[model samples]
Target: MHTSSTNNDQTTELDALLQILTTQVASLQASYRTSNTTERIPSLLKLKNLETLGPDSDPSLNETRRLIVSAATQLIHTVQSPIEIVQDYAGSTFKTVALGFVVDVNIPEVIRDLGGEKGMHVDDISVHVGIDTSYIARVLRYLATRHVFKELTPNVFAHNRISILLCKRRSFEEIKADPISRFDDAPFAAHVHMFSDEILIETLSAFSEFLKQKDLSSESVKDGNPEDTSASGPQSSAGLGPRTAFNLKFNTSKSFWEWIAQPGAKYEDLARTVAVVMRGGDKMVDEGQLVNAITTAASGTPIDSSTTDITNLLPLVVDVGGSSGSATFTIKNKVLQDVSGIKYVVQDLERPIDSARKFWAENDPRAIETRQVELLVHDFFTSQPPSCQNASIYILRMIIHDWADGEAKKILKRLREAAYPPLPLSTQAVSPEPKTGPRSKLIVFDTLARYTCDDPRENLNRSGKEGSTSVPWPLLGNLGVAGEGFSTMMDLGTMVALDGKERTRDDFEQLGKETGWKLESVKPGKLAAFIFSAF
Candidate 1:
């Protein structure tokens, strides 16, 4: 009787979820049609070519799509066998291996060259990639079953919407001519390669062993906070050098950055790939949104450049650890093109500073010639130079997630000291505030990690003030696979690679408080802008 009751309850829950899915699907269809000049939703097998009219282009459409995906995922879980789900999870590593294999061998490019939709036989593909015919067929077949590529026939494969994204957009001949620079133009492909190739794959393979063997050595324990002695999780040991799964696998004491910075063709290739991935991250948040975030954080109110003299109010914007000043240039060109006299400084290591000089020289020589922009070869771990101290704004784009809490604190502390330098011992008692001058703002642009369960703490925090799109009933608060997958994956990747983490809002607030900064506000998006003011 109890078994029957439980089954009936599950059936009722599935029916409710199905209804929600139907409603969401209808809403999505309507949104698509309205946004795309009354065009109908395309077939599943058809190639997607909607540029500005893509699902992500419209907010309502994206929200509806998330709902549908979440409902469908939950529905699948409801009916799918436990063993099947476990098997799928266990076999996912091969999926990554297969993806990395095809990308490395340039299968996507080969298929594109031959015939896009018409399809190519495995025998032909084998000739192009220099792999065994049967092996290529099996790999392609496996990927096809997962909808990565299309299987037009038993042993024939073709590029689909998903597979086409991995293309280098260069001719097969061009790729062959310069295989080293093939990924130079293909950020998405490079992204896949970086994640699936030996660097991450091999590092991740040591995760289980690394977890099982606890490092209770003095090196690990000394660097960590004495009060926070939690043995269940990984701890950061910046002073001791890299000690994560990456360190275990690579058998190196240097951090991932230091290791990658080593002089070698292989490291150079990996560095270039990293740069491409970072460049691709620009699409996460719009430049206009970033400008608004900066203005609000700097002035305590959003200033309209047309109405206010933004140049006079905010004299300098320091790009901390900014590689080649791409984000800075985006803000300058898009929003502050006409706002002259506002100095922009791009700070990084020697290599990136040199890259910045070259980039600016080719793009806008006047900015460099007139001294409006300065490229400084400075490390964030060190103190901010006298010239750049107490700037109106310091932008740290995608910087914080690269370090564990200990190192991240050091970086933030350096910025804090520069933003509000300590007063003399005699005057310190009279004035609690660090300085009489205008306070400098720190804007950290990074991923705002989300949780699957609905945490009320997030609702009460400043970072959570900007409410997310309402998830439908029965769907996870974060929309499960549809919404939080990338962020969670990134969290794990950072853990294995750098002993870093994608932090939640409370975590950010606590980190800020520890380093003598107060979290003032948050501008949420694909990459959130956590605005802080030195206290």
Candidate 2:
């Protein structure tokens, strides 16, 4: 009787999940119909045009997607045996390794050139990549099973929608001609390679052992010698200590940035990958939403034709540590295109500032020629230069997540001091009050971490703000594995690589309060904008 009852309960839960899946599918179909597209699942042959759909681009579609993925994943968990599930996860590393191997060997480009959609046999692919036919078949089969590539026939593979994205657009010959610069035009491919390559994979491998050690604190980790503490064994870069899993794996005392700066083909390739990845940060938030966030924080309202003149109110925007000025360029082109008298500055280390000069020279030479945009070399750890002290807005995109809480606070404090500079002691008797001007705004564009379980505090904190999504019952609050997967993965990746983290709403609030700023509002999207005002 107890066994029968247990089976019945399991059936009931499965039924609930199926119902959720069915409902979400219907919603997705309705969205497709509204956009005048076929109400069928997107084709595997090509990328979907959901982004171009007018009204169908609403948050409802994303919500439905979240529900469908969550329900389906939960159903799989319900039916799959524990041992099977564990094995599937245990072998997951092979997926990354296989994907990386194919990408490194330029399999996607070769397949595209040799056999478009028709597919290529393992023998042909093996000849092109110089790998064993059987090995190529197995690796392709593994990826095909995961829906990364497609298996059209026995020992034959082709580029599916997912795999086709890895194409660098250059011909196979061209890529081979310039092997080192192959990823220069393919940022997405670079991003995948960075994660799956030896550096990140080896770093992640040390995570388990690294966590096992006592005193994983920053101080302890920084102080301990890698030679003495590394359980894996000693490394070539001896004398240096382990600050993170990356440090432990590589046996370097230098930070991720410092280590990457050293001269080497591998390090240079990794550096280029990181720079390319960072260039895509602006795409994380919608342009309109980002513009509104910055303008609203600058003035008391959003930008419009009849909006109050911001020339005298807020004259300049300083992008602190804004590598290559991509975000600054987005702002200049989108919001300040016609707003004359207002200036823009892109601040970074000397190397990035030099890159910024080249970037601006190509994109908008007039801005630099007219002195509308200035590239400045500055470090966030040091005091803000006198020129940037009175700037109206300071933008930090994907910057804060690169450091731990303590280091992150120092960066914030430096910006806070710049935004609200203390009154001069010599003029205390004459003008003692704080400088009278528009309250300087600090726009931190980064990921906002979400909890897997429902948290009432988030609901209260984001009461009237955007970026909050409702989770239906019977699913994890953050939509289980469907939603927040990338963010959580990034959280761990940052921790492994640089001892950094993604922050929750409470974390941002506390950081703001501690750094003499007030968290005014949050504009959430792929990368949430945390707008803070100097107190």
Query: What TM-score does candidate 2 get on C-alpha atoms?
Result: 0.85
The parts of candidate 1 lying over 4 Å away from their true place are: 1-11, 37-39, 49-56, 213-240, 301-314, 337-340, 421-438, 460-465
Q: Each model's RMSD to truth, in Å? A: 5.7, 6.7
lDDT of each residue in 1-535, candidate 2, tens digit only: 0112234545676776787899888878776666655534544665433236443455547767777888899889989999999999999889878888888899988898998878899899888889999988888889888898888888888887688877765788998898877887676777788888787898998998666663656463443221133322111122224657888888877767767778999888888877777665556766776787777676642223344653332467899888778778878888777765667889888888888899999999998999888898886766788778756788888888877666677678778777744423442132312244456778998888877776866652121235444555567667767877778888889888877789998889887776676787777666778888776
Error of 2 at 146 (Å): 1.2
For model 1, how does the per-residue alpha-carbon lDDT over 139-249 read when each residue is reduced to its tens digit?
A: 988988888899988788888778877788678889999888888867889988888867778899899877666466634333444233232222123432546888899
Q: All models: lDDT?
A: 0.74, 0.73
- How many backbone overlaps does candidate 1 show? 0
| Root-mean-square deviation of candidate 1 | 5.7
TM-score of 1: 0.87
